[model samples]
Target chain A: MESLFTWNFASEIVLSTFRMATPLLLVALAELYSERAGLVNIGLDGIMSFGALAGFMISYLTGNPFLGILAGALGGVLVNMVYAFCTVTLCAEQTVYGMALNIFAPAISAFIYRVYFGVSSTLAQATLMKTIAIPVLKDIPFIGPLLFNQTPMVYFAYLMVPFTAVFFNRTKAGLSYKSVGEYPKAAETLGINVVRQKYVACIICGLLAGIGGAYLTTCYVNTYSDGIVAGRGFIALSAVIFGHWTGSGVLMACLLFGFCDALQLKLQIISKDTPYQLFQMIPYVCTLAALAIMGAKKAGPKAKGKPYLREER
Target chain B: MKLGGKSENIIIPLIAVILAFLIGGVIIAALGSNPVDAVGYLVQGAFGSKTNIGATLVKVTPLIFTGLCACFAYRCGVFNLGGEGQFIMGAVTAVWVTVSWGLEGPLACAAALLLGAVAGGIWGAIPGILKVFRGLNEMIVSIMLNYVATLFMGWVYTELLRDGSVPQTFPVPDASKLGRLMPGMRATWGLVIAVLIAAGIYYFLFNTSKGFQLRAVGLNATASRYQGFNVKRYMLFSFIVSGAIAGLGGAIELVGTQFRLMSGFALGFGFDGVAIALIAQLNPLATVLVAYFFAVLRTGATTMQVGSGVPTSVIDIIQALVIIFAVAGMAFVRLPGFKQRMLNRQRGKKEE
Candidate 1:
């Protein structure tokens, strides 16, 4: 046990934690925005799956990872428009429609992928995004290597943390978004276009989730596999609740989830005797525990999961 | 002319199915296949022969159980997304009892199924207890439990209950296996049992006072609480009972069809059940019909793929579209203008 907790091993785990957490952080942030605007988008996993395929295909074709990321985000927005239409414009059940997309998008994505690239023994690879190191910052003692040296996507995810904090707390648009979620009728009466805000929130959520999905294919790994997105999208959903819908809280929650993910992978490698499936269960178990402990008291927006209609008395 | 509530409930989903099929045809055409030929193959595959019908019915059996599971829970306003987890736990427990314990005879089948339901109920109660007592979100907790259950199942098969040479549990005893409706057919009496359960659920939801209170809780929890209904208890009851249904389905699938527990056992059935329940408007009888419809699509998908060279995933796309269109159309029908227009039409007809 003492040998297992060596400095090198601990540092490796921490570094991997950041890498693992990047997608979760991005998707959780995306979910935070949608939920804040009273739109519960459970289709994050589906969007991510589509994004992964789009990102992989585009990067494979264009030989440009950034273009693939862009395509992924745009593809996400395109798919999310269906959700926006059903939930925002039509005022349908948010969870049901979101789940519909969750079922729909993945099938379409797989269909497209199979059409473009026939089944083969060898996995089609994409150009992975290269890690970028800040020059002087990398030379700094402990924190430098821990934080400064990482992929551009990882840096961007962390950068959004503060941006989101300020956007929700300080900005006028953010407050309006919050108002729409809290009380759509009141927000509408106050001259805010509640429908438009909800649409925008869905778009933002889709785009970020797409990027998170793309990161798995184009940045984290160089190839795409079926079910690559797995349940990270759902974990991100949990992170939103576990974080109490705050930006920093979500970051902390995502990091903890990422740690569990990384630890599980490491433990799988370290212990050959124990079934790998037991280790694989760690992240989900932790998420459940965290939600049970932290998600009980604080509730989300008042108008969440309800269809807001302007004409209804 | 104004349509009755019962007819409207049926018509909207019917229209959605037609619309989805039309769109699916267009997609198949774009994929360079003859849409007409694909449809022919789909029909032929699902109902081609006695064997094909039996296979389709076998698929429908579990779907009916899972669909009814979702329908029951949703009727109580509880989203028990843990149906898949409950199903897996049920299968695991049944396999353990049937094979590991070496249970024998007809009693073994009955005992295995009951134990499976109990296991599923316990697995489902976790999220319910948390939601009622601790105010945790049931949906997320239930979904998380799915992953845990799946991993646990994996561990059981690969580590604990693994049989000779393969990573799967031992097959159930021959005597414990469910009897078929017809000789040499794969379809078991499970289909009959599932249909009966659906009828039982329909009666419970529409007939009993307790069921009425459950629906009241689902419709408006606060109002139900005001009316002296224990809303929390209803929600928890829905979760447990719903879970038991799914678990029973899992056991039925195990003994009735899949005698050996393996990887990918009962994957996607839970979500499929959710979609079926929603598409059926949460009506138990309608759930059985919708489950059958989904099974038809699934059973036909392989044939369509083989004949037309289109991927079987096109069926999945079609299924998703049906859910989307049905949900969106139902919402549209519920709009004030539409409802008001129907009322006005009926009133004008009476005056004439």
Candidate 2:
């Protein structure tokens, strides 16, 4: 146990935490945008599934990871439009539409994948994004190897943290966007296009979630499997709540979940006697604990799950 | 054209179903298969023979329970998304009772079922208690419990209850297995039990004053509270009852058909239940019919795959499309313009 807590093992765990947390961070940010705009989309998992397939297939066919990422974001936007139209235009229940998409998107994605690739014993592979080590940053002792030595997408996710914080706290457009969520009727009276703002939020949420899904196929793993996105999408949703809907808070929450995930994976490899299934349950259990501990007092946007209508007084 | 409130409810869902099938046909054609032939095969496969109908009914059994679970919860304005978890825990507990306890005969079966319902109720109460006492979001908590329950079940089968070389629980005693409806049929008494439960739920929701209070709380909690209703207790009750239903379904599946706990048991039935309940507009009796419809689609998909080379996943797409259309159509009918148009049409007909 003492040997296990060495500097090398610690560094490895830290690195894996960042690696595992990347997708969660991205998806949580995506959820943050949607929740802030007063639309709660619980269908992130389905969007990610679609994005993963689109990213993998595009990368496989074109031999370009960048193109795959682009395709993934586009695919996510396409699927989210269905959700946006149903919840935003039709004024339907947001959670119901979100849940419907969760079922719909994954089935359609799997269907499209089978049509393109057919069933085969061997899994198809895609080109993975290459990791780049920053020159001077890499030489900064402990922090350098832990953070600087990573794929481009990982850096992009970290960069989004500060950008999102500034966008939510500082920008004028951001204020208008948030107002729609808090008081859509008031926002409309003030000349803000509430429906347009919601549509835009859905698009951004879908794009980011898609990129997160793409990262799994094009950077983390070169192959796509059914249910590959797993429950990370839902975990990200919990992170948004755990973090209190703040960008930095979400980042910390995601990192904590990632750490748990990484530790479980490592433990499974090292210990044979212990049931690996118990280890696998750590992240989900942690998510529940985090949500319960957070105490849902001031959870999110006031109008968050309520359908907005322009015609209603 | 004359869209009264009652007629609109029935018409909208029917239109949604027709639209979903039309879109599904287009998808089949796109996949280079004859859509008409595929539909024909699908219908024939689901109801052509006694054996096929029995298989379809068998598939419908668990779905009816899960659908009723969602129906009950949603009627009380609670979203019990942990039906899958509750179902799993019930199956696990039933297996523990039957195999470990070495129980046999009808009494053993009854005990296993009872214990399974209790286990499921406890599993569901966690989310309810958290939501009521701690003010946690039940949706996320329930979803998290799903993962935990699945993992726990995995541990049970792989490590705790491993039978021989295979990663499954020991089979229940033959005497404890549920008797089939017919000697050679796959369908068991589970279907009758499910249908009877549906009727019980319908009666409860429609007739009882307690059920009225629950639905009243769902419709408007503030109003119900003002009228002297215990909103939180109703919410918790819905969760427990919903969980027990799902748990009972799991045990039934085990004794009635599966007879052993294995991987991939009762997969996707929970979400399918949610979809079915929503499509049925939260009516318990309607849920049974919708579950049967979904079962027909599911059971037929395999035969359709064999006959036309179109993948069974097309049915999933159709089911999802039905949900989207149904909700959207319901929302559309509620729009002011549509309502006005219907009113105007009715007035014109009256004058004429």
Candidate 3:
């Protein structure tokens, strides 16, 4: 326990904590956008599975991680297109459609994997994304080694933080997006295309979530498996709620969850007396606690999961 | 020439099923297999022989209970996604009782079942109480608790109740075992109990005053409260009942089919129940038929995989597509094209 107080151990834990939180950060932000636009993308789980499989398969076949990332984003766009058709166009219940997509995507990915690679070779490893350290940024003493020297996806995720915050708060398109979520009828009256805005927002949500899923496959585990997402996508959903559906809040929530998860791994190593499963359960338990405490107090988009039919009063 | 009526409820689902199957066939074709042959194998495998049919019935048994669980809560306007967790908790609780107490008879089995229900009910009630008092989203709460229940059950099994030399618990006693309905098939008397439970849920939801209150709350909570119903209490009551039903599903599966509790037992039956409930439109009576349909798909999925060399995950794809179409098609039929068709049909009828 005394050895754990060393700077090296602390840095490693902090580094891993941020690294682990990257996927959650991405997905939570994605969910935030959709939820803010009044569409509940409950199928983020499915999107992740689709993205992971597509991303991994592309990278494996072509040996290029960039292509994998693009494929992941495209896969997400395709899935969310179906979601948009159902929820936005058909005016179906958002949650139910999302749930269906969630169930469907995994099967689609799994079946494709089976057909292409055969059922027995599912565990075949793929080319992983390479980590690139920023040259000058890496020279800074304490902070440089901790934050600057990490994977490209990590930097991209952090860069997205302010960009999303600005887009949500500063831009005309952002206000229109919020208006559609809060009051679609009023937004339509104001000449904002409510359906179009929702479609766009949800598609973007899918893109970010898909990239997050690719992050899981390419950066973290580097191999696709059944249940590889391992409830991270769900955790990301919870992070959106826990963060109170803001970019900064989402960042904090992801960090908190990542810290819990990283700490669990550390504790399991340091202490053998405790059962490892208990440690493994920290993030989920923390989510429940957070939700229970915060509960439904924070009001999200007023028309969040409701389908907007233009003809309906 | 009616556009919207009671028949639309039935018709929409039928259309959804047809559309989903068409899409599923397309997927099969994409996989380089003959869609007709794949489907033929699926149907034949599901009900090819009496034994196969019996196995399908066995698959349908737990689904019936879980479907009722989802339908019951949904009717009262609550989403109980924790059915997976509650189901597992119930199974483990029953397994723990039978193993720890060394009980051997039908009476002991009855006790274990009751214990299972109680444990599952408690597991479910946590989220119910939270939703009522704290005003949390029950769906999210249920999702989180599922992980907790899964991990907790695994811990209990490995640490306390594990059978010697194996990952599973000790075998349940013969006296406690449910009697097989068919000589050569795995179908147990649990099927009858499942049917009875479905009937009971139907009666309770449609025939009783409380049922009416529950349904009223589901339709409009504010109106139900204005009409002197305790909406909060009913919400709580709805989840407890839902949990008990799901827990009973776990208990039944344990004694009747598995006879021992292992890790990963009763995989995703609760989630399937949600799908079943959606397909049935939250009608308890309809859940029986829907559960049977799903059971056929699931039971025959293995045969479809073996004979056609296609993965059984295709069944999941079909199930998901069915749900998507069921929700989407119901709304899509109200669009301009369908409305125009309805008008044309009405004009034709007038001419006739």
Candidate 4:
């Protein structure tokens, strides 16, 4: 028990927390945009799984992790195009399509992998993104090693944090995007193309989620496995809700969730007698608690989960 | 035109199914397997023998329960995604009783079944009450609860119930086992129970005044509230009933087939319930047929893999495609000229 409070353990927890939080950050950012644009894209888990598979497969074939990232986003676009077509264009039930895609995408990815690589084959080896430390920044105290010495995606994710803030708060396209979510009819009256805004938002959402998936495969795990995404996509969406759809708020939410995730993994190792299942449940329990506390007062998009039929108005 | 509307409802789903199979064929062909032979093997495997048919029926039994669960909540305007959790808790509680209490005979079976329903009902009611009181999104809450329930159940099995080599609980007492309808196959009295419950729910939903009020709440809560219906109460009731039905699915799968609680035994069945309900368009009776159809595809999946060397996940792709096309109102993909002509016809009718 005395050793449990050691600085060695504390630093490990802090470092792993950032690593665990990266995928959630990217995915939450994706869902943030889509939800802001009046679409409930809860199918991020499935989309992420597809992205992970495609990224891994491409990196395995080309030996280029950068190309893996690009292909991963493209994979996400292809899948979300179906979702955008159904929910945005055809005005299908958003929840139903999202749910179906959650099941469908992962199964298809797994099936393709199995067909190509056979069920008995070992995990494919691929080039993993190496840790890149920002030289001057790395010399600083506690925050330096924690934030500066990390993978390229980690730096990219942090940069996007501020980028998203500027994108949403100051940009014209972003303002129009928010308007489409708030009141599509009003936005239409104001000369904003509501459908077009939604389509772009949904596509961008997929692209970001794809990067999240690619990061999981090429940076963290370096091999594709079933369940690699493992509900991070869903957790990320919950973070979006917990943050009340703000960029900084989502960052805090993802950090909190990442802390819980990292704590669970650490506790399982340090405390052997405890039921590991209880430790495994921490992140999910946190999500439920956050939703319960924040849900009632949430100020989400007004036209969310509803189809926009221009002629009906 | 009225008759045409009803027929289109049937026609659209059929078209979606056919289109899914055709696309699936293309996928199979891309994988270098003969699509025709693969589908043939799938059909034959699902219905080749009495035993095969019985296995398919056994699969349908649980699906019916889960489908009805989704159907009930969907009709009341609730999306109860916690079928997986409710089902898991139901299986855990049912198995816990059988192992700890050591009940036997038909009376024991009744107790196990009743206890399973109650456990599931309580689990179901949690999210339902939360939605009404706390204004949380039931969909998100329910999905979270699924993980909690799954993890909790895993903890229970590891810490308490598991005393042997396997992670599952000890088998339920033979005396409490569901009676087999076929000696060699897995089909049991649960199938009859499923059918009767489906008919009962159909009667409750379409024929009874309370059911009408529930439907009214689903269709127009504001209007129902104006007419003095308790919208919140009905919504809660819908969720509880939906949970109970899904829980019963877990319980039936436990006593009727698996005879023990194992992690992931009921993994995708809950989502499969969503698919079934959607395909049936939330009709209770239609769920029976849809559940069976899904069951055939599921039960035949292994055979499809064996015969075609194509992964059985092809079924999942087909089901997803079916749901998308069936729900998406495939109206905008027509040729430009055709779409223009249709628009002109609509305008002409409006002018007339």
Off by over 4 Å in 1: B1-4, B341-352
Off by over 4 Å in 2: B1-4, B348-352
Against the true structure, candidate 1 reaches a TM-score of: 0.98
> Interface RMSD computed for candidate 3 is what?
1.7
Candidate 1 residues B1-352, lDDT tens each?
Answer: 3444677788889999999999999999998999999999999899999988988999999999889988999999988888899998888888888887767978899888999999889888999998998888788888889989999999988889889889988889999988899896799998999999999999999999999999999999999999999999999999999999999898889988999888899989889999999999999999999999999999998998889887888899999999999999988888877778888988988899
Classified by CAPRI criteria, candidate 2 counts as medium
lDDT of each residue in B1-352, candidate 3, tens digit only: 3677667778878888888889888988888898899888899889999988988998999899888888999899998888888888888888887777877788878887888888788888988998999898787788778888888777776666777867677778888887888688899988988899899989998999999999999999999999999999999999999998889888888988988877777777877899899988888889999999999998888889889976788888888888887877777777766788889988988899
lDDT of 4 by residue, B78-107 (tens): 889888888888888778777778677777
User: Against the true structure, what is each candidate's TM-score?
Assistant: 0.98, 0.98, 0.96, 0.95
List model 1's recovered fraction of native interface contacts, to 2 decimals: 0.77
Q: What is the C-alpha RMSD of each candidate to the true structure, in Å?
A: 1.5, 1.3, 2.0, 2.6
lDDT of 1 by residue, A1-313 (tens): 4658998888889999999999999999989999999998888988999999999999999999999999999988888899999898788888888789888888888888887887554788889998899999988887789888898999999999999999988999889889998999989999999988998999999899999999999899998877788789899999988888889999999999999999999999899899999999999999988887764765778888888888897
Name the lDDT of candidate 2. 0.90
Candidate 2 chain B least-lDDT 10 residues: B1-10
Worst 10 residues of 1 chain A by lDDT: A114-123
Per-prediction DockQ comes to: 0.79, 0.79, 0.67, 0.59
Q: Local distance difference test, per candidate?
A: 0.90, 0.90, 0.86, 0.85
Query: With candidate 2 superimposed using the best TM-score fit, by how many Å does residue A137's alpha carbon deviate from the native?
Result: 1.3
Error of 3 at A28 (Å): 0.7
Ten contiguous residues with the weakest lDDT in model 2 chain A: A113-122
| Number of the candidate with higher lDDT, 2 or 3 | 2
Task: List candidate 3 stretches off by more than 4 Å.
Answer: A2-4, B1-4, B334-352
